[model samples]
Target: MTFEQLSDMIAVVENDTFLEAAETLNISQSTLSKKIIKLERELNVKLFDRSKRKASLTEAGRIFYEEACRLNQDYFEMLTRLKPYQGNRRQRLCIGTLPILTQYNLTARLKLFTEQNTWIDFSFEETEEAQLLVGLRQKKYDYIIARENLFSKLGCVSVPLAEDELMAVLPENHRLCSCSSVKLTDLYDEKFILMNAYTSIHQLCIQILKDAGITPEIVRTGRVESIISGVAVGEGISLLAKSNFRIFQAGQVKVVPLDPPTKLSVVLAKLAGTAQTDAMRIFADYMCNGCEV
Candidate 1:
């Protein structure tokens, strides 16, 4: 029989009566009697003599009770020996985000949160917007930080964090690099080095140019850093988020503000209708309350 059934049998034998045993086990007398009866049926042996004024154990019950007591003691002893192995392990949260994450002070804020809440461990994936969406959809990430416009139609629960601006990046020696700001029309004749078409920045750049009725001559498409590197070597000009400019140490690349200032909204999002753990809920609230980073 089950360990619970065996324990209940032992309780009935040690207690003064069925009523006393039920009280000790915090179960009804009827329920306890039914369990013992079921156990007797399973073993095809009577555990108690109901004919007596007080319930007494049968010969078979005496043997079973002795074995149950020994087994119960061994079970507890095994648990005691294994308790040390179940040490204080922290719960982990997996987060995916765009490569521009460091541009904001989110990492510093996360460090502060982690310091105060030592029970949580964080795992981060800093990749492109396309990969972030894929990881989020596949449930490989607990949460994701990405562009709001790209994920708006995904029907996810999103918390808009901050506004970002688009800027044009050109080689330092390029003729247009000296301008205070550049318009999409001004770059009409220049070869464009763009990030992958699937990225939010790439999509936004193309849309902004189309709205201005300018078709760019795209020379290449790759990751953000690769696009920037290509621009630095005078390969072509590329557009990137304003915050991303500060982190790139390439002095050969000149970052100029976009004319008319195209702005983007960044958001922290999670799939809708999905269950969140206690830590996830707490972290989401913390981010929502002070989400400037």
Candidate 2:
């Protein structure tokens, strides 16, 4: 039985009548009777003799009441012992971002962050931009790094981090690989390897390709690793943000700028109107200055 029901049963045992127990528990007498009846159904035995002028407990009811009392005491004791650990949990902060953003530079910066903030614990989640916003709203993450407008539909806040231009990642042996840069039309008729729909880049790149007056052929859609792999093996050439260049390995893939560069604004997002703890504010300040570093 639930702890609530167990406690309610105990209240009944301590009082002289159902009316008295209901008053003590601050619940209606009807609700109290129903709870006891439910308890009896589960036990398949009578807990109260209804025919009595005053409510009286059966033999099984007396034994169950005593056990319930002991259980209630133990539950409170467990919470008392765990109180310290709960405080420790509150001292931790979680950050979430896309796998692409965690490339060489940001990864090194994160390592330094943890080293400097030794007093606190940190957790990280790498996922698409869509889930990052959801995590922020659900309080699954204390902070998120993603496209600026991703949180527009949400009531959360975001500090602009950096404006990164979109670039193309092509196979080393591709005809356009030798070019200094590529235009939307340059990639015409070329099969594209793209990230899943949850990623802002997926929609951004598609629209850009279509605006260049070509029907984009999406050969595949998946994680950043899969997109990079597709480009490396000549499966298809794909476009990604310049800041994410570190996620691609050299020799296998060549990163070239787009002729008409398109910039995407990155931001650090959090609950808009919430009070920030000292640790959270300090961490957010560091993230806001990402472009300076």
TM-score of each: 0.62, 0.59
Summing lDDT over every window of 10 consecutive residues in candidate 2, give the lowest-scoring window: 81-90
lDDT of 2: 0.78
Most lDDT-accurate candidate: 1
lDDT for position 182 in model 1? 88
Q: Once model 1 is optimally superposed onto the true structure by TM-score, how far is the C-alpha of residue 73 displaced, in angstroms? A: 47
| Model 1, span 1-293: residue lDDT tens | 78999899999999998899999899999999999999999999988888988878889999999999999978865754453455564567888887666777688777776766566777778987777888888999898987787786777998877778888998999888789998888888888988788877788788888898888889989977788889888999988887776676656899998888988888888999888875677678777777764
Q: After superposition, how far is residue 92 of candidate 2 from its true place, in Å?
A: 4.4
Off by over 4 Å in 2: 1-92, 118-121, 290-293
Clashing pairs in 2: none
lDDT (10s digit) by residue, model 2, range 196-258: 876678888877777888888888888767788888888998887776665545559888999
